[model samples]
Target: MTKPLKASGFLGLATMMVVGLYQFTLLAGGNAVPGWMIGGHAHLGVISILAIVMGFAVPVIGVTGRLRTAVTGMFIAGQWGIPGVVWIGEGAELPFLMPTAFLWGICLIVSMLIMLYATLTQDSSGIGGEATGVTPADD
Candidate 1:
């Protein structure tokens, strides 16, 4: 699970770098890329970072087994799906896909929420016997 998420993140970053250079070239040529394309690129970058962060967070938070799989899958799907729909919709001039992209966004949000809830609900020892909360230094 962690491997796939991290891989996706790295892949997304690579893709972003390529698209960003393309966008730069377009701007340099005095060709205006659509606002929606720019928006999709930004989303791709952010979601990619989120995926990488979540990959590291998963093990530390002790979201193991099937639950971890589900959460990881959600993040991965959002990482790919959101901007994909946007790029496809705008590039193809099919505007309807814009609204549908929100569904993928929800997956990303809910996955984070699950991580938060798991962290907060754990006992003082936390999951896998690791501390989930901060401990102040003795004065």
Candidate 2:
């Protein structure tokens, strides 16, 4: 897995944690939590983890060259884009944010589908060394 993807994942988790702390502080201060913040917090965690997993998955699925680059970029974009637009849109009370969020979500789904297709069409017909009972050390 690449460092960038893992770093992004960790960064997302850190952001989520910070948001959670802010939410707690808000509650403590007798302020109501905003719905947009809640949504952003959730997405930060989810997308971050997905980015990390996809980092490991990309090479396993044989996604190389330009396609790999595209998919990785897409996932990285989605890791930050979804939550960012949501927070900005909802925080600023913009109506267009929801559609933008949907678009980001769709981007994530498309990235996953690309990796899935690669996995499905592989010659081994299985993922990782375990599927074939062959360990990396054997290779």
Clashes of each: 0, 0
Model 1 Cα lDDT, one tens digit per residue, 14-105:
99889999999999999998887798899999889988888888887888777798898898988998999989988889888889788898
Write one digit per residue (lDDT tens) for candidate 2, span 71-117.
Answer: 88888888898999989888888867767877777778888888887
RMSD of 1: 4.8
Let me know the TM-score candidate 2 reaches against the reference structure. Answer: 0.85
| TM-score of each candidate structure, all chains considered together | 0.85, 0.85
lDDT of 1: 0.87
Candidate 2 ranges beyond 4 A from true positions: 130-139
- Mark the regions of model 1 whose C-alpha exceeds 4 Å error after superposition: 126-139
RMSD of 2: 4.0
lDDT of each: 0.87, 0.84
Query: Looking at model 2, how many pairs of residues clash?
Result: 0
- After TM-score superposition, the amount by which residue 5's alpha carbon in candidate 1 deviates from its true location, in angstroms, is 0.8
